[model samples]
Structures are given as C-alpha cells and as structure tokens.
Target chain A: MGAHSLLPFTQDRDTAGFFEAAAEGRLVFKACLDCGHALHPPTDHCPRCGGWNTAWKDAKGTGRLHTWTTVMHQIHPDFPAPYTLVVVELDETPEVRLMGRLQGEPELREGMPMEVWFEPLGEGGPVLPQWKPVEA
Target chain B: MTATVIDDELAFAGRDKAAVVGIGQTAFSRDSGRSVLSLATEASLKAIADAGLTVDDIDGIVRCEQDNVRPYSLAAAIGAKNLHYWADTGPGGVAPCMMMGLAMGAVMTGQAKAVLAFRSLNGRSEMRLGGTGRHDAIEVVGGFGSYDEFYLPYGLQSAGQTFALMARRHMLEYGTTAEQLGAVAMACREHANQTPHAQMNGRPMSMDDYLASRMISTPLRMFDFCLESDGACAVVITSAERAKDLAKPPVLIRAVAGGAPQDHRPGMMFPVVSREDMTELGGRQAGAELWRRAGVGPEEMDLAQIYDCFTISVILQLEAYGFCGKGEGGPFAASGALRKGGQLPINTGGGHMSEGYVHGMNHIVQAVRQLRGEADMQIPDAELCMCTGGPLPIGSSVVFRKAA
Candidate 1:
C-alpha cells in the first residue's frame, strides 16, 4: 500500500452484500432471481427482464483478461504513476466484467487466464479485488 | 438492442424545419482571466449580432447543464426582455448538438422564435476535466450512485484512462498501429495550423512528435488528449422561414438524434468497461437514426465535425457514422482521408484536439462555418456537415445542410 489511502467506498442497499462478501474472501455478484441474469456492480433490478428480485451469486475467482491499460500518469495521490489496470470477464459469466489493479509484471494478452485475490486496505479500509496471472 | 426508439412522426418533425443562422465563439486559451458569465455574455451577444438581430429579438436560450453560466443570468446580461423558452442539456462534451436539437424542437413547436444555444466554461484554470482537480470521487448511497465505485479505487480515474482501454482493445482486435492513432492527432494539428484562431495553430505536430509525446495512458499520448481551454461558443437558431432574412445563409437542421446503447451504464466512462463490446459506441444507433431522418447517407456529407475529445473519439465516430465499416477506423484514419482535400475532411476548425475543448460546442460552430463557406480550411462548396456529440455511451448527433 502507498502512503495515501484508497478512495472511500460507500455501500448502499444494493452493494452492501458485495462488500460484505469481499470481507470473507468470496467474490459475489447480484443475479436476477427471475431470469438468472448476472449484474456486475450490482443493480436493484434486471435490465433485461425488469425483475426487481435478485440474489447474490459467488464468482469462481477465475477470469480472462478482456482489456487492460498501464496508467502512466498519476491522476490521484493515492494511485502513484506506472500502475496497470485490467478489466476481466468472469469465467462463469463472460459478459459480466469487473475492473481492478493487476499485480506483478506479466506480459498480458487478451483472453489470458487470471485469478482474483483480495487485498485488505490496511485497518478499517475496504477489501478490494485484485488480479494476477494464474500460476503455471 | 437499439438504445433509442425513433417515433416516426416526431423524428421527421424537425427535419429542415429549423436552421442555425449565426455562430460565435470566444478566443481559445489556457486561461481567460474572466468569469464564465462574461464569456457566455460575449459569445451570446456576438451570435445574436451575427444573425443580424438585436438582443431584444432573442426570446429563448438553451445551454449545457454543466456550463457555469445559466439561462437567466445570460438573458439578464444580454438585456433580453422576456424569454419564451429556456432549457439545458448535458454531461458536458455530449450536449452541443443535443442543445441545438432542443433549440430546434423549441423553435419548431413555436415556443420561441429565435433561440440562443451556448456553452461556456473555464475548463483549464478552474475544473480541469482530465486532471484530478474536480474531486473524482462520488457519493454512492445518497440516491446518486454511479459507476465510479468500481474503478476509482484502482486508479482508473480520468476519462483518458477509460478511453485508453477502448483504444487498446481496438488495436488488439484490428491491428491498429500507434501511427494510425498518430494520423488523427496530426490531421487535426494540420487543420489547426491553417486555422488562425486555433490554440495549436502555430504549433504543428508530426507523427514522430506524436509518437514521442509522453503517454498519459498506455496507448494514449499527451497529444492524443484534447486541449483543456477556457472559452465559450454560441449559435442562433430560428425557423427556416426566418433564416432566409438573416445576415448569413441558413444551415438547415436536417436531423438530430441522441441515445445510448441498451447496456449503457449510468455514469459515463467507468460503466463502459462493463459494456459487451468496448470498441463500439452509442454512435452506432444514433448515427443510423441521424441518416434515416435526414434522408441522407454518410456519403452525402461534405465534411464531418466528429467530436475529438481524444484522437480515439474521432476514430470511433468515423466507424460509428458509417464513414467506414466496423474495425476499420484505424486504417481509415491512416489513409490520409480526414485531411483537407481528402474524403470526408473532419474538424475543419481544428476540433477539440487542436482548436479547443468547448465541450463539442466548437464542433457545432465549425460545422456552421463550413456550411457557410467561411471556414479557414473550408471544403469548397461544403453543403452538408455532420456534427456528433459524444462518442460516449450516451450521445447525440446532428446533420446540417446548406439551404438550397
């Protein structure tokens, strides 16, 4: 961790479960109860079927890199320069993607297999999902 | 799924019914050393004068929601007695053509005879959009939840970074070279070299310069980002009948459409990562409707003022507007087709990349100038110009044609 803290995360009714599950090292997403559609970054209702009822589903923690960027300039004090960010398509739901910081220097390729690891933001900080190449 | 369902009757209602009679803009600069209201007032008065009308003749005002100046403040400054209609539209860079679209609706509906649509901001000195000055965090629980929650923690803060991901994906999928992206920056810079008022006019950029420029985000260089400037731009809109007697020839508002993709996430760039195809933009559906309502295709356009908040934006819009096919924007840009005297010359006034970032307002002003045959890098006999708002998920576009 750097000297600066991560930006504060605010949990609402729709996202409280997501952060709560992260504390237990289990990645979770909201799935529509009616249509079984998965919502990333979770929503109150299903966009496809207009279903209000939803349930939290655990993710497999494995995904493929859809796209990535190595941020060269520092936009925030908390995030120092020369860090890489990746958007990963979950193995269970390819369409449901999540963004996170990529760990270790790896020659990244699209569709490369990766696994998620949780990083505790020091004391009282929110747990964040991070990505790294799957070990051979 | 199409983001917008066009009403057959309403879609065609404003086509050729309203016209842009005047265009005005303040000098593009890193800092204006003046209030936004003063900038708005100067541009609004200039636009009114350019239309061959006095301030009293203006009965309506339309503005971007993000603009620091408000309609009432502008009206008071301009000395307009009574306003018949007033409205604002936004998300900043996406609202120029949409603002004009609203003005067209107000005029066609008889809500106002002459409406002034304007955007004014001290983007550089005050609220630098591409920088961290604006407090990039969001309050998630207070009924104002946004997609920022996902990316802000990981340092994916600026719009440039979000767009960089899209640019990188395009390169991966299509073998788009850095030179191809350089082509867009160079083309806009060349146009700026011709445009006396462009902020980058004296400073020409070469491909080597573009390549050598330090990277802000992986594939996106400093040159790839748009200039953050302090400026204001305004246009006067009126009924087609009234346009005939104006000081300048009328540029008919052929068509206007604004919409987002079906999976468009609420908060601009952050949610875009979750979109199915990162290479695609809202321009796909919006462009289809634009051409449909105008009864014209991309081939009919004399030029395009595609919003260039970044070099990639122009590339995406080129593909979105059907100037070329999908996954072909890189090669299309590299073909030297966007420069003056080439096929589909774009941003003849230098655009956001070279001219200034007035949140796409300058693009509209440039389109009007090209159609009027008054652009510094004018395309000879330019009759039709297409100005697109955001290449973002939620965006708008308009087709302007010189009245026959």
Candidate 2:
C-alpha cells in the first residue's frame, strides 16, 4: 500500500487588510507595549507580558531566509509540488521571523538574502506577502 | 473547583506548580465521527468527573488541541468559567506537563485556584467527513505549505520521511536494525494490550508484523509511526497540599523544563538531521537539565513515559536521558529490559502509536497513573515516573513522583 499519511486540511483565514497593505509594498509586524517584542505572526495580545496593547509597525522589508522547504507533495489537492516555503528573519527585529513563499524558482539554501513581495490571491482581496531571492 | 472559564478573553498566569486532580479521555479510535469540539467535551467531562469535581469548579483553562481542536471554542463547549489562562500550544505531547508546571507556578504565586490542561483531536472524524488539511491548488501557497516547502520539493515531506531519514542515520551510525525498531513497537504493544483504552489494545505484533507493515517513508515502516485517532485527554493541576484530600493520590510535579536545540528553527533538509544524524541534541540537553533539577537520574525512576511519535524517537530519548550511552540505544532496547516488570518499563500505556494519539498528553496521564498505582499494566511500586514532551522545533520533560 502507498503511504496514506496525509495532513488534515484547514480553512483559509481572511487577510483582506493584509492584502491592502501589501499592495502598497509596506511590510508589517505587531509590537507589544509591555515587552516591545515585534510579533512575527501578528497577534492581538503579547504572549510574554499578557498585554493586549499592540499595533502594526512597518518592517524594513529586508531579511535573510532563515530556512526554507521544497515541497514534493501538497497536503491539499490544489497545491502543486516543489514549492518553497520560507521563514525570513527580519533585520528590523531579531526575534521576528515571518513565513512566506519565494516567488521565483526556489532554491532552499538557508540564509539566502530575500526581499518581500506580494502576490494577489484568492478573491484577490488579500495580496499575500511572498518573497524572492535577492539577485546578485 | 471544577468550573472552567472559557471566554474570548485570553489570559494565563506564568508557569506555576499546580497538582492534577482529574484525568479523563475519550475512546481512542481512528474513524470516530466526533468533531474536535465533541471529543474535547467528552474527555473534559470525564476528567472532571474523575477528579470528583464539577465543571463549575474550574477557574482557569489551558487548551492543548492535539492538532485540531480550537482552544477558544472547546473552552466554551466545556462552559469554562473565570477563564484566566488559555493557549492552544503546539500539537506536541510535552504540552500537558508544561501546563502542569505552569499551573504549579500559578498556584505557588496564588494566581488561580485550579487549572485544567486539556487536549483534543478530531483529525480522523472531522477531516474524513469533509474537511482535511486544505492543500488544494488555492490553499497550498501558504499555511500547509509553510513548513513543507522546505523539504517536499527535495522529497522530504511527511513525518515518516523526516523520521525515516533520522532512523536511517541512526541505523548507519549506531548499527541499529529494523528488528530493534520492531522491539520498540513490540514493547508498546505489550503495554497497549494491557490498557483497554489504548488504540491498539490487545493487538499483538512481532518482528514480522513490524517488518511487514508497508513503508510510509523510507526506513520507517507504517508500524514505526504513531496512530492518528480522534479523542481528547485532560489533567487537572491544583495544589499537592489540597490534592491530599482529593479522590486520587497526588503525583508531585518534581520538575519540568522545555527547550529546543540551537538548530530548532527551520530545521529540515538544511541542518540538524539534514544529513541523518539520529542523535537528538535537544533530547539530551533537556534530559540533563531535568535530571539535575529533579535531583534524580534514569536509574532512580522506576519507569518512563518517553515520547514515541516514532520508535526511533524513543531510542534517541533513551540514550539522551542517560538510560544508556550514545549509539547503544539499539542494544539497550533489545535487552527486552524495558517491558513491564523490566528495569525501565518505558511507555507502559503504549505510546502515541499504540495509545491513542493526543499529541503526547496521554504519556503524561500514563505517568500519573504509574505513580498513582492505577496503571492498567501497573509496574511494581512505581514511585517515580518521568514523562517527555514530543519533539518540537522544541521539547520539554517532567518527573512525577507519587506524593507522599
């Protein structure tokens, strides 16, 4: 029998505002009032300080890909194989690393320089933030 | 004090020493039609009833959704009250004990009266019904693809694939064999057969069954992996002083700690295991710290509830925790010295593969049972039981002693 270890599916979350911001080419992060740790995956409250006081801050839009994966299989049927998912460690905040995809043909060597970009996705309301290798 | 608080307002007191007063679980099955919410409800109520407490008595809740259950919603379903602490930690098994450690901190600092750490999963029922990890053409560019993108392209996608790579490396370096891997599974089956609630209860396997199981990923046959079941598990942590008056013997939280190796982040085809080095640095590091803090070593503990997401993981953890020397995990496991009534008696409740999978929470609950003298395959006078959280990009461990 072939391997049947497939991952369960999850519904998409709306990020229309994220798309709106991405269309303008401004990267974002959430800053906690209590600890000042810039949240990589934006959240409403500070996990360390228990403080909900947070706001979106503009990122420098430059970072190195901390790690990347090359997909040979897709958990969902629609996704094509050989996709690169990457986590970019932003230079602006040492602790914040956001996940996105590399736009061009992907080579997943860790620590490659990356620049953020946006791709219009599902319903075209949210311009999903994507990344690409820095051309030397 | 079983009333649990599960409102939208998220809050948690930092780590504390809270004792477990209740324990509950739903039947472990692969195709149960229950939603994540329902399984959580079943386990939560059973646990509360077991604790001899009512749901209305709980004041804080920490949700460890074993890959599916939503914390906020499950909290609501259980009618959790006061609801101060809530987080849907990783799908790793080490979470429940981590919660207990935090509860102890809260109790010591006087932040709350009691906290319920609950984990629920409905991947089989919910997804098999209609919803599964959506990786369709439209969804694949994000989320599910997030971690997969690194390896799937290079042919390293599934957990079996990743673990197999590790196992292969271990085999090459330690001269381990497929039969030794079978020993780990065989041992867990022995324990599962004894525990009625275990997913593979009463099912017997030999080297043949283990070796015959079709390969899911190279070097990791199907039997080498964990079973996916729809269920929930919970452990209530209060105070040992107060726990003495409760329904069951209190299992003292000796010490609990969590950490990831420096190579934890974005680990994949690039490092840590990129080359198949099976020795886990994180497991070893956590073991040293846990032993030091608990004032004990592997020999002091009567038994262990090591995380067995994969048979190789158990072997690695055994060595890391000083059960034996590096690369000696194969012979160490082969000694048949780890089965019931054996010197170490690891995974007395089966492990993730044989016990129902609730991340690793069942392992924690099993350790509690060992200390409480309630284990189905109770080890003789099991006074100290150590539990490990499943690997993460991070990991954790806790040593539990039957409260005197």
Candidate 3:
C-alpha cells in the first residue's frame, strides 16, 4: 500500500490530534491528565489510572536511540528496502517510547541523542516522523 | 509484580489427569493441493486410528481460531456419534499447547470422553500469512484488534521486523552477536538433516551458509525465518485411565499454563514501543506455573521443543523460561548445549526453523516422540519434555511426561 493510503483511521477520536499535528509538521503523544503518565498510539482512557481524562501534547522531539533494524528487503511498496527503522525514548517522558524511521545515514550508538523530523509521504501528503542524530 | 506460584495440592488437580495417547500428521509441504477440511479429516482419523480408537470414541474437538477447518466439519467427516464439547482457541501459533489444556479441561469436566486437538492450515496456498493486506481491511479481523493501525503504517508489517528490533536491544545490552543467533539456526538444521520427514532433511546448514545468507531484517537473516508449509497435525487426549488401554504409550499432560503479560497488550506483531523491556515476555509468566504444576524445574526437562519461528525467538525463550539467566542466552546457545547429548536437547524434529511449520503442533508431536523413545535424535531416557507455543509477550507452554 502507498504511504498516503496508510493514514490513520480518521474516525477514531483519540488520534484526531495526531493527524492534525502531523499535517502541521509537529509530532504529538498522549498524556493522562489525571495521572500525568504518557501514552502512545493514542488511547481514550488512562492505562495507569483508568481515567478517561487525557490530553495531547506536542512531543519534545528529542530522545536517545534505544535500538533499530533496517529493512534489507522491501515488503511494502511505499517503504523501500535498506531504510532504517528505530525505537526511541521520548525526552519529555523517557518511559514512553516511539517508533519511526531514520531520515539519513548517521552513526548509531546505544543511548546516542536523536530528534524527530518530518518526511512527507508525497507532495502535499501526510507527513511521517523520522528520527536522525543530533549534530555534534 | 511477584510471580504467582501454584500450590502442590492445586497443581495436582489437572496433573497427570489426561494423556496424549496418539499423534498423527500429514506430510508437510509448500502446497498440499487438498482442501483444509480434507487435511483436517486425514490427520484426525489417523490420530484416532493411531490411538486404536474409532471416530465414535472422539466426543470432542479443539482447534486454533485461525484454523480454516472448523471443528464441526471435522466432527461430521469423522462421523463422530456424539460431539459433546469443542472449542476454537486463540490468536495464532500460541494455540497448539493451549488447545491441549482446553481438551484436558473438557475431559476433566466430563464434557467429553476423548478430545481431538488439531491445527490444520494451507499456510502457503490458501492463507499466505505473510501476504500483503491492510490490518483494518477486514470487517472483523479476529483477535488483531485496532492495534494494527498503530504500526502497520511505519512498515512494521511482519513478525521478522518486530523480532529484529527486540534482538537488537538484546545485542546492545548483552553484547550478543549475530554469530550466537546463527548457532540456533545451525543446530536446528543439523537435527533436520537426520529427520526423515523434515522438508529440509537433505539440505544441511553450516555456520558459513548462515553467514552468507541474505538479511531479511537487520540481524535476522533469511535462515532465521521458518518455512511456510501446508500441513495438519492432531493429537488425541483421553483420561489417564482410558489411555492405559490405548495403542501407543500415553504421554501424560503434566502441566499447562498460558497468560498475557501484565500490560496485556495484543502482542504478536503490534507496536511494542510502550514496553519497558522489549525482551520481556509472558513465557516466564506461563513458565513459572508450568514448572510448579509439573513439580519439576528447567533442569528436570530432558528435552525442550521451544518454539523457533525465528532464531532470536529461541534465544529469548531459553532465557525467559529460566533455562539460563537473562542476557546469557547468546553464550548459552553458542555453547552447543541445545544439540543432541548436550545440556538440553531442543527441537529434536528440527523445529519450525527446519521442520515444516505446523505452527507448534510439530513441536508437541516431537515431544511425544522423544518421551516415547522413538525420535530420530532420541535423547536417552527422555521422561520429561517441555513444548512452548510462540514466545511472544502473550504465549503458552506445556510439560509432557512419559506414562509410568
């Protein structure tokens, strides 16, 4: 499937902010308003407190590289082979982690600094979060 | 959270109550050219016959939820006179050992006399589990809830990618190398070379072959993946008293435990970015109960038929199930302790890596063979064997013992 076609289900209320922020070139993650715990992939209720009070906040877009893998062979047409996929711990909430692709070839080391950037799926299409190493 | 330990008295309630009296399987192949119902019927009838019982003796049936062949269809084909109980268990490869637990539950409750638990699939032909399709494309995608919407867009489409991510973390933390992972693949291929029924039987693998193989995902070579095969396997379970009069020696179902992690996320291939430790899995959650119920720890297991969907999976499971300390699996596996006459003979029938992947049904069958003293790489005096489903965060396990 094409990258543009793989957009999130817009009907889901929890992810409404994620798509809006992505369109504006900003990444967002959910945090429970009641317990101050960060959540991922957008959920309605707090996993920790079981409270429905939750809010979306702009992510700090900086974290440390945890681990990653490069798709040596292409499975999806939209994603070419040999692209790096990464797992990063968010700077705002180290307990919360996010998965995305690396934007460019950069030296990878455990706990190295990383920051999120946007990669458009196509011209005027939905953008995706891509992480890269912070300049030394 | 503290691990829940089952007391000795409660553990005996289901311990040695039911026995796997028969096991039958069709030839594993890329294409069977037969309907799934036909495959299920063939395996079911063979298991019934192998147990020296008739279809009328089978009062119940159990299968995986993903199985194309329905329980009622197999019951009808086998001319089961009275189908008292039947159930379809969950997710994917994690159901084989759990199906035994369900079957045993049926027998213990007098819901059925003899229960046939089977897994049949045309994985390569009908359902290319690896085929391209949107997760939300289906109206009701069984157990794979809405979690697919999270990771599928990021090209985390297959189990290989997710496993590679966790394996990379292990490497970073423990300094595990690709060479350690290769040892698992090499060891299974060695077992497959001697296994007459194994598809990869004639083609043995070496460390050189493993190193030269193309990488599918980083650190996960093509050799790490299991073959997509079409086949069916069935095991017949009856009361221990009834199994005493059966055709083959009964392999007693000593213990069974399966549960989700505390997070209880839908595991297989969903985005696990939220997990604190990627290497953590419910295998240990179930493992603790399995050992308690079986009244034996890892050291007492004469052989282990751990799930080997990928080489990394085997390494992780060895550690999760307490066969070795955490971060010690790479060295433990590379030490050749998992081979024949080694510390723990694992996957004697080649495992899913080299054996045809009947999803873990083959593992259970191999465990029965080892306990029966009939395996190709039979370990001497294998009285107890451990078989696991997939080692994902949500998994299942069972302990089988030779009938005294």
Among all candidates shown, the one with the greatest TM-score: 1
The DockQ-based order of candidates, best leading, equals 1, 3, 2
lDDT, residue B60, candidate 1: 92
lDDT of 2 by residue, A64-90 (tens): 765444444344343444354565677
Question: For residues A70-104, what per-residue lDDT tens digits would candidate 3 score against the true structure?
Answer: 88867766666777777889888866677777533
Clashes of each: 0, 59, 0
Candidate 1 at A15: error in angstroms?
A: 2.2
lDDT of 2 by residue, B1-404 (tens): 24545332222222113467788888878767767678778888887788877777776677654446665576688887666655555545667757766677766666656777777776465543111354433323223324442233223345554555567667756789988888889999989999888889878888888899975544567788778777778888887777877888777887776666643434322234421133574667677767766778889989998888889888888887788898888888888967987778999988887987777878878888888888888999888888888764556788888876
Q: Which residues of candidate 1, in runs, are more than 4 Å off? A: A4-6, A103-106, B1-7, B134-143
Q: Please name the candidate that would achieve the greatest DockQ relative to the true structure.
A: 1
- Superior candidate under DockQ, 2 versus 3: 3
For candidate 1, give the lDDT of residue A59: 91
Model 1: how far residue B370 lies from native, Å: 0.8
Assess candidate 3 and give its lDDT: 0.83
Q: Candidate 3's residue-wise lDDT over B258-314, tens digit each? A: 866655443345646567778877887888878878889999899899999899999
- Pairs clashing within candidate 1: none
Against the true structure, what is model 2's DockQ? Answer: 0.06
